[model samples]
Target: MRRAPWIRLLLWHASAAIPVLGAAAAFYGPALERTGGAWPAPLDDVYIHFGFARAAALGHPFSWIPENGYSSGGTSLTYPLALAPGYLLGFRGAWLGLFAALLACAALLDLCRSLRRLLEPRGGPGAASSRWVGWVGWLAPLFVVAVPLLDWSWFSGMEVALLGAVLGRALVAVRRAELAPPARRPAEQLRAGLLAALLVATRPEAIALAAPLAVAVAHAAGSLGAAASLARASLPTALLLGAQAAANRAFTGEWGAAGAVRKLLLSNPYPTPLEKAVEVIKNLAALRVQALESALGGPWLSLVLPLLGAVAALDRRSRRVAVPLLLGAYGSLLLVALNATARYQNLRYAAPSLAMLLLAAALGAEALARRGRLAAGVAAALAVAALAAPSAGFARQIDHFARASANIAGQHVEVARRIAARAPRRVLLGDAGAIPYLSGIPAIDGLGLGGYRGMPFARASVHGVPAVVELIERLDPAERPDVFALYPSWWGGLADVFGRRVDAVKIDDNVMCAADEKVIYEADWSALAPPGERRAGVIDEVDIADLMDERAHGYAFPSPRGGWVIGAVLPGGGDGAGGGGGAGGGGAPRFDAGRLIPEGREQSFTIDAAAAIARGPAVLALRTDGGGPIALGVAALRDAGGEARVEVPERPAGRWSEIRVPLRDVAPGDRIRIRSLLGTFRSFHVWLLRP
Candidate 1:
């Protein structure tokens, strides 16, 4: 604890930080400007926690939407609680997020220092410290800050940095005591237990990290007797976790957070437990492959660090702590890998494993340094170079993240602020991430990712069909979004499908819900009107529907007519929709898309007969096998189109209605098409009539 050593350590920490932070600043500078003074994290999920923190700071429990009561929307119980103070002090958005990450990194540096001190075997009878111990000690922290993935995690405003620091601290203390078991400090042991508790509270996943640490701590505390020491080490953790579970159960009616359950329900690949376990192994294997691919560019550096470290840990000098450390790291990783099946999952899932490997490498480097100056230099240089590519990769990643942040601020954040200013409090909306957080209103998430209530809809499988439409249709009447600030593609067709008149306030390109007005518009119907046909308008009905993609607000399913149905509702629509093979309802098949167009909405079909249509007004007609109220709009391809609903006084359930639309209503042109603006008809057709 000499001043010289402390000062040298401080300088080394600062040296490691400057370049990494400089790269971050370089990326964040323009981002800050683009976001209009608010720094946004790259991931929208970060804002979910920020919102929770903001809510918690206001003396409420963690909630993105307080109006909807407590929903375990935040990923970590402790992180939002930790971030609450920053929000109370008025550091909002990316600023608050960065502060939390930086705080964790500081803790990380402290843990690294403690680890270096604990691992360096100071002047034992056979112990010889390496000449490069001082420089090599700083390498771990340097590697952490320099790597893009690790560095970004700290700034991404998640629990990674905090988890790293807490886990690292406990491991360091455990290592110190394991090395000198006779001098087991009860106070240190209790503190490690508390840290472990905090780690678990930060992320339920840390339970895996804690399980091994518990064994090691008990093993090291043998002097105090196993049971007594185990109790001392476990009591605090158990109490903390039990209390959290009780609180969550009381508030959210679930153990842990509903979010985790919801995620598992949504992502779980199999129906049965045994199958799920098998799938989990496959997913972990896949993740391993992905991590290997990522490290292929720097295989020697990546491979050597962990291998040398693991090998060094077996040496008599480092065996006491290194063995348990390696076991815990790998054990936790295996557990995480088994549970993590996200298609987009990456190496961050195995952060603790990586940390353990790095520590082992550091120990290995120290041992090599003990041999000679040349060996130490080579070891340190190799380790540094190994991390260099990742560091550079992360620097570029920061730039990409900055741009994404800017986009979120300009679009989602700005729109959220606007909606908050205009929309009613507690109104439900779709795509409920940033807007709900920024607006301080409850959102009925259209995509089903954020809030717990939307879990069913979020997890709903439309079997490669349109998820948004099926989700909107399935949502309970009470849970339906009152206002939507989503793209036209999301809600334009929704108005027709649901029979709700949705007035959209155009906020740039994204649509804002204007709830007071009962006016509904589905995309720009005029835009969908064939622009003189893509090729010659094929009179094929199936081909017409196939073209309406997200750009066209259309989803395609199979049509019984030896073709496909675009955005059509098929038979067997009930509670078990999309669950299995259809249990058919004894009703005529229906085509459903756009909002539920109860009265009727426009449907367009391309006509190939341009010359025939030009010669005379097209007689637009449809033979409905069953008809109540029928309507059709006929138009030349260039015409604005005209609507005509047939009045069937004797409405019959199973009778054909031969309805006709006049050519006078349509502007003169060749390639004519038809639009069903209002009313219902089971099926339709058109033909050119000589004037």
Candidate 2:
């Protein structure tokens, strides 16, 4: 019996640990500084897990929004669980993720060393150790560390690293049984089965790898062998998944995790099987487009390295061990191709598969070693050159980590602080991750990731405008936001839907709201009739086209605008503050001939009578649809008392109210004001034009 290769294993593992440690320090050191020693993961998704883990640690159920009931917003079963013990110890945040990542790297190194020993047995008959081939296995860990996706994923608080490690262990066990066929070790089979079950629970995508692997391991015994292997793999996997589903159902009133629903919703608006198939194809195309640069490093390396790996995998001596690596890589990629919707961010979806491919590349280099020193050197040179670009990309990602922590994550923390300071009570919010998590508020997640599922704008499509509108619309009255502080530009077409003009106080560069009292638009604006016919300039002289009942003049507007206008009497304000129209819902002003304009587009109105503003500062109040405020500019104005020109800027609410524009020396009866509807407004009403 040969003694254990403890020295060699330790040396190989140490070699791998060096780069991982160095990278961790380089990336996480600055992240610590940026986050003031908390070392929060850069991605928003990381907090999604942290929220769950923190709850779990506190002896509460997993939930992104704790007040919102049991929410299975977390995607991984084991990751949050892994964070549990440490969180119980009061050590939470990126440090936990980083430690998990280090363990995963060490596991990968051990798996590679074990696999090398299996392929080239020591002290066995006719077994001559190949020195260069040994170097390939030793160097393989370096490849794993260098993959850009793996680097970011390790720090992302995601399950990628852990999944790869467990999956590698499972493959090694199954391949061991296959290598010594006809003598199936029940112990190894049981170990492999347990690992496979954990793999499924880890990411769910490993089912692709697990199924094929079980069959391959059982192939020698014909039908009977296959059945046994299938049962062994299937039973444990089924039990774990079934138990999870039952727990999820009991806790959240849903069978699967909320994340599954969110992903499915993101994949297709129509949840039919056929639409799902179409979605997979679309996702595949996107993956292909992004795969070369993001996953495989670049065009040239992606093409060349895989061909070399294929050649090495085909060799008879390397076939037994090589097959599983190739299968793992291809199966993982297929899983990503079918399931992953988000294709960018450099191999995030296919991270485990990349580890497999890296091993295959090393195997290919090993096969080259057998041919000659020159061939091995060439393979090594190409591998190094191919890795250079990703190394640079990884460096940039470190910078991304720091910047995101400072700008995005830090801003969220600050905003949550301000919100807490201003509104001590819980508030409904969009981008529910950081704000609620930081502020300890009970929030309604507009994106539904935090488990508020009544998102009307939640669609399979990535278009955010419709999603946000639907999210806001779907909220229960009780769940309506006090003030929405989201990026308005992201909510496309909202300016059209909400009639684009209201009185608002600008809060941050991104925030604008009326403090619980301002009306965005008059409720009766939708009752106004469409402008009839294209009458030239000031229709009907004094009236400007009847100023009521939708008979307003259409100028500088789109053509054939009768049906283009749609109206809705939006429900009264959720805050229960404003009265619409009149006290008894009578004598309210009607707005008509309103047009929805594209963002950054403006429309103007010219008033011929200078006496319109003769009475003190002329009032030019306009009604608007209520999403928020719209800017109105009044230029080339006049006072009724004399030939005094003035320009006034005003933002009006969703009412028939008037803005008091100041006048120099106009008398109380004298009026002088010009109307120029500015920014994006639903409709402008001129009361003075009434006949």
| Residue-by-residue lDDT tens digits, candidate 1, 1-691 | 3357568657866865665466456656765675677865655567777777877888776666555556565768788888888887878755676666566656566655555565455662124463456566656566455455455555556677777677667767666555554554676677677777887777776676666566667777757776766676678778977887786667644564555544562243224566666766776675555443243225544566566566567666665456656775666666665553342423556655566556666666666666567877777776666556455365455665566666566566666776677654344444455777877666665444455442333332211123344434334544445555655444444445443434443322221222212232222121122222322331222122222222122322222221111244343222211111111223434333322222333444434323333433444433333334444444455555443433433233432233444555332224443444455433322233343
Write down the TM-score of every candidate.
0.64, 0.63
**What do the candidate models score in CA lDDT, each in turn?**
0.53, 0.52
Question: What TM-score would candidate 1 get against the native?
Answer: 0.64
The stretch of ten residues in a row with the least summed lDDT in candidate 1 is: 575-584
- State model 1's lDDT: 0.53
Q: For residues 465-513, write the lDDT of model 2, one tens digit per residue.
A: 4334333433343455543434344332443344433322232322111
Give the runs in model 1 whose Cα sits over 4 Å from its true position. 1-3, 33-37, 93-95, 101-105, 119-132, 179-184, 265-282, 292-296, 316-341, 345-353, 367-378, 389-392, 427-432, 445-481, 485-496, 499-691
- Candidate 2 residue-wise lDDT at 32: 71
Query: Each candidate: RMSD to true structure?
Result: 16.3, 16.1
Alpha-carbon lDDT of model 2: 0.52
